[model samples]
Target: MKNQNIKVRKHYLLKMAFLALPFTFAACDTEDMLNPVPETSISDKNAFDTPERIIGQVNGLYDAMKDGQYYGGRIVVYNEIRGEEWINRLTNGVTGLQTWQQNVQSGTNEVQNLWGAAYAAINRINVFLQGLEDNKAKIDPTLYTQYQAEAKFLRAVAYHSLVTLYAKPYNADNGASPGLPLRLQAETTTANNDLARSTVAKVYEQILKDLNDAEAGLPLTYGSAVLNTTRAHKNTAIAMKTRVYLHMGNYAKVVSEAQKIVSGTTSFTAPTGVAHALQADVALPFTNYTTTESVFSMPMSDLDAPGTQNQLGYYFNAAPVGNGEYYLNAAGIVNDAQWPATDARKVNFIVTASGNKYLKKFSKPSPFTDYVPVIRYSEVLLNYAEAAARTNDMPKAIALVSAVRKRSDAAYVFPATSFATQQALVDAILKERRIELLGEGFRAMDITRTLQTFPEKTGSGLNAPAVAPSSTDYVWPMPNSELATNKAL
Candidate 1:
C-alpha cells in the first residue's frame, strides 16, 4: 500500500496561446501536491487576462480527468473487472490493476490514485469557476456563462466518479450513507482541508444541481466534432443525468432525462447541430474517436496519448499486440449462447486465443491513445429502456432495448411477444447494458445499483475467497492519507 497527497494548485494552467500549439500541452500531468511549488505558478486572478485564456483552463480540466487513473483506463477497467464481465489476467506482471481484482485496502495505489486524480481535477474545476465568476466583467457574457456551465459539468462529473467508488451506491438506504467530503470551494493555502463528508443525499443533490445548470447553459454544438465530444454540451449533461438518476432509483427521472436526448424516437439520431447517434458499426466509436453515438468521449490523440503503463491497451488487447492484463468473463458474455453468435459485437469485440477471451474495444496500439467514451447515446437509450421497464411502459422498454440491440445483432431483435413481464424486460436491459458498455466503464456501478452481488468473489489473483451479499468490500474506504490530514472526516 502507498499514500498519495493530492495537492491541487493552479500553477499547471496553460496559456491560451498554448492551446493552439502542439502536443506539449495536450496532456495534463500532476506533480506531487506536497512537492515544492513551481516558480511559474500564476496568480488565480491574473491566470486569465482574456476569455480565451480560460479555455486553456477548461481544456486542462479534461486532461486531469483523462488521468489514466480515472477516465484514461483504471477508472473504466477497474469497475468492469470487479464484476463478472471480465476475468482479470493477473499473470502478466500484475501490479496496477491486480490490486483492483484483489480488492485491496484504501491505501492501495489503484484506489488512492482514483481518489487523488479525481480531487485534483475537481479542485481545478473549482478554481476555474471561481476565476470566471470573479472576472465575469472582463469576459464576454456569453463565453463567461458557457465556461461556468462547463466547469460545473466537469465538477459534477468528478464528484460523481468519486462518490460512486468511495461511498455506497446512491440508493444505499436511499443515499443515507456517508458520501464524499464536499470540496466545492476553491481552496487557497489558508482554507482548512478539514471538511466533513456529506451524506449521499446531499452529494446527489449537488450533482443534480450541477448537471441541471450545465444542461441549461450548454449548447448543442461547439467549435468542432473533436471539441464537441471532448467538452461538455447540453446532451452530454443530459446523458450524464440519466446515469445519475438511474443510479438513484428515480426511474421516472431517468426516463424523463434520457428522453431529452433520445427524443420520441427509439434510436438516437444526432439532432440538428449534434453529430451523435449509435455508430452503425459497433467498433467505430472506439477506433474512430467520435461517432454519431458519442455523447461525451474524453479526447485522446497522438498529441495526447494516455501514456505507456496507464494506456487502456495494456489491459485489454491481448492477442498479438497487447500484454493481455484482463480477459472477458466466459460465463457472462464470451461464449454465452444467449448473446447471438453472429452479433457484430461478438465477432468484432470479443477477441479470443488459447481459450481465453480478451476484449478488443480498447484496442489502441502501444502508447495507447483510444479516445475514452464517457457517455455514449447507446447507454442513454439503455437507460431510457430500463426506466421505461420500471415504469411499466412495456412497449417503450421493449422497443428501446430492441432498437439498440438490433444495431449489433439484427438477427436477435426481440419478437413482439418477447419479455412477457417487467422483470423479464429489465433482465434483458441489464444484459444489454453489460454487453453494450463492456469496456466503456458501466459494469460495477450497474451491479451495485441493481442490488446484485459481485460474482467474482473467488478467483486466483486478488479476489477474496468468499464475498457475501452484504460485504462492505464493494464500497471503497476513504483513503488513509486524506483521513490523516482532514480531521473532519
Candidate 2:
C-alpha cells in the first residue's frame, strides 16, 4: 500500500511540473542559455522508495531555513534592534532599524524577505505533507510516520516565528488579538481568498498540536551527524515546548517541560562528557567543534550557497580590526558591568578598545561558516531556572542560575539575600537571560511575553513607549502584501 502511494505521488508531482513548464517557458524569452529546459517532466515513480530522496527534501527545507531572508538575515537584525546592546544611530545601511525603534509602520525589504522566507518554508512543508498523504501506500509505515512528524515540526516552527513577529500575544479575555492568516493547504485557489486571522490562542493551539505530534513521532536521534545537527528531533520538539509554554505564561508547564530535560528523564540529556556550564574560557564554549551543547543548529559551509553563512561572525565582530560591524560600549552601561575581566568567554569573544566592545561570537573571518545554532543546552538550563523561579522553586532556580554564573566566573547568582520577591527574581532572571542570550533572537519575544504576563510591569507615563499590554506594538504588523491578499488579516 505504501509503495503504491509513492508511485501515485510521483506521478502527480511529475504532472504538476509538466503543467508548470508553460509558465516557466513563457518567462524565458531569449533564453539561449547554457542549459535548456527539458520538454517533459522527469519521472521518479520509485523516488519515494529511497530514504535518500526523503532526506534530500528534508535537507532542502533546511536550506530554506537558513536563507538570509529568514533566520539568516532578519532574525539577527530583529535581535539587535530589540536589545540594549545596539543603538539605532550606529545602524548604517540597516533598513528597518529606525522604523523598528519608533514603532512606525513601513514596508521594507527586510520585512518582505522574512515574510517570504517563512511562507516558502510553510509551502514546502505543506507540499511534503500533501505528497506523503497522496503516496502513503508506497511509503514505508515508519518512514511515512517520521516524514509526517518532520513536516509538522517545520510547520509549527514557521508559524511560531510568524506569530511572534506579526501578531499580538494571546489574550484569553479579548479573544481578538490580531494573528497571521493560517495557510494549511498545499494549493491555493480563488475560493480561499477570504482567509481571516486566527486569534493568538488559536495559533498557539495549532503550534502545540504540531509540536506534540512531532515529539511523539520523530526518532530519538538521526543516523547522520548532518541530519542530527540540521534536522528536528524529539529533544528539539521538547525544547520548543518549553519555549511555547514560557511564552504563554504557563510557568508550571514550563517548569514541567524544562525539568524533564534537565533531570535527564529521557534521551534528552544535557551536554555531558564535558561540563555543560559556562566556561572560564568563554571562547571554549563558542569553539564547540565537538560538543553537543547545540541541540539544534542550521548547517552551513564555506561554499557559496543560498542559506550558508557565519552570521554571528559577520554582525558582531569588529569590521576593520576583526570582521564585526557593531561596536559594544567598552566602558559598559551606566548600571551594568563590562564583560568580566578574566572570563575567557568575554576575553576571546569581545574586543575592547577606545571604550568600545566589539562582538566575537562568530570567530570565523568570512561571512561563510558551517552551522548556526538556533537553540542550545545552555538556553534550556536558563529556561529551567526561569521557570522554576516563577513557580517559587527558588532554591533549585538559584542553584541552576548560580551554576551557570560560576562557570562564567561571575561574583554571585540571582535572588541574592537582598532580593526576596517573585518580581525581583523575575527581573534578575530577565537580566541574566539578556546577558547570556544577547544577539540570539530572543529579546523581543521575551519583552512581549513578559508584558503580557505582568501587565503592571508594563510601567510608566503616556509617552514612555507603550509597554506590552498597553500598546499594540507588542505584535508587528503583517507585511503589506499579506494584508492586501489576505483580507481576513
Candidate 3:
C-alpha cells in the first residue's frame, strides 16, 4: 500500500513538472545582456513572437540551468562530496549527506530532484527550439541560427550532466551501459512519458552532434565580456567538445576539438575567438567572472541568486558567512605535498576555521551570487594536456601542464623524473586538475572517467566506504519519479 501511494505521488509530480515554466524572461538592454524583468507572464503563443521575446527565451534557458538543483550549486556539491575531497560536517540531509556517504538511492531527494530539473530544462529547450522553427519568419535568419545554436548548446550541457550522474562513465565498457531517455522533443504533456533509456554511447553521440552543430552556428565572439563569459559562442562549444571527448577516452578527438580554440605548445592560448589564455594569476578568474580565462560561466546577480541552500559558499564556508555543511577532508587532496601552501590556488581559496579547512572559491556572503564556472580556459588547457599525454605528444602535454601550473605557482617546477613516461606526465596533469578545480566540481567525473575507486573517508563519525567500479553505487539509480511513469525504464 505504501509503495502504491508513493507511485501515485510520483506520477502526479511528474505530470506537474511539465507545466512548470521558467522565470519571467526580460529583454537585454544596451549595457547588460541579462537584465531580466521579473514577474511577467509569457505564454507559449508569445514566447517567440518578437525579437525581445526570442532573446528572453534564450536567457530563460540559462535561468533554467542555474536552478538550485542543477549547476547553480547542488550538482557541483554532489559531484565533489561523492569523491574523497570533502568530509560531511553538518550531515544535513537537505544538502547532500547521502551523496557524501556514497549511499544515495533512487528515492534520494537529490537523485529525484536533479533528474527532474535537468529534463525540465531539456524539455524547455526543445519547446523553445520547436517554437523558433515554427516561427522562423518572425526572427532574423542570423538571429534564428544563433538562438538555435544556443538552445542546442544548453541541451547538450543538460544531457551531459544527467548522463554523468545516472549512467556509467564512457570509459566503462566504452559507454555500453544504459543511459538517459534522450528526450529531444518538446514535452508539454505526460502523454509521451513512456520512453526508454538510450545507450550511453548513443547519448554521447547526440551530445557531440549538438556540440558540432553549435560550433557551426554560434558566433565567434559576443563582443561584450559578460556575453562572452556567459553565452555560448564558437569557442564555448569547442571547449565543451574537448571535455566531452576526453570523458569518452577519445584522446584524438579531444586534441582535434581543442585545436579549434587552443594554439601553440610552449604557451597555449585561443588564437582566434576571445583570445582565451591563462590568467596571469589563477585567482583572477574567480575574483571576476568576466575575464578572458573564463570560457563560460553561469551568471548570477542579486536579482537572480542561486538560493540560500544552493549557494556553494553555503556548503563549504563556516558560520557568520555560511553554514559550513562540508569541510576539506584531512586525508584528501589538501594533504598532497605537490600542492604547496604558497600555491595561489590554495592560499586564495582555502580558509581555516574551527580547526578545519573550507573552500572559498564561491566566497560571496549570504545570498552567494558568485557566477558558477561551467568551463574555463584553464580546464581546456588541462584537457588538451591530458589528451596530448595519452596520445604520446609528451612535449605538448608537458608544456600545457607547465603553463597551467606556473600560472598559479610561478616558482614551482615539475620534478626532473616526473615526465619519464606518458603515464607520469598524465599523472601530473591529473593532479593539477585536482588542485586547479578543487571545489569547482571535477572530482567525481575525473574519478569515474579514470575508473578509480571512490576512496573511503571518515568525518562527523560517518565512514564512507570505497566504491569500486563493479559496485552498484558506482552510478546513481534511476529516480523513482522516472520509474513510476516511464514503463520503458
Best by TM-score: 3
The per-prediction CA RMSD against the true structure, in angstroms, equals: 5.1, 8.5, 5.0
Across 298-317, the per-residue lDDT of candidate 1 in tens digits comes to 77778888766676677778
Per-model lDDT: 0.74, 0.60, 0.87
TM-score of candidate 2 relative to the true fold:
0.80
User: What's each prediction's clash count?
Assistant: 4, 15, 0
Off-target runs (Cα >4 Å) in candidate 1 are 1-42, 91-102, 264-266, 270-275, 413-418, 457-466
After the best TM-score superposition of candidate 3, give how far the Cα of residue 475 lies from its true spot, in angstroms: 0.5
* Candidate numbers sorted by TM-score from highest down: 3, 1, 2
Q: Candidate 3, residues 1-489: lDDT per residue as tens digits? A: 778956665665454344345334343344443453222222465567788887888898888888888889889989999999999987789899999999999899999988888887888888889888999999899999999999999999989888988999999898899999999987655567689999999999999999989999999998999999999999999999999999999999999988888898667889888989887877788878899999999888899899869988889877767889999999988979889998888888888999999888778888988889999999999999999999999999999999988887889988877799888889999999999898888999999999999999998799999999999999999988778767887
- TM-scores of the models, in the given order? 0.89, 0.80, 0.94
Q: Can you give the lDDT of residue 82 in candidate 1?
A: 71
Error of 1 at 136 (Å): 1.4
Which residue pairs collide in model 1, if any? 102-462, 276-292, 277-292, 277-293
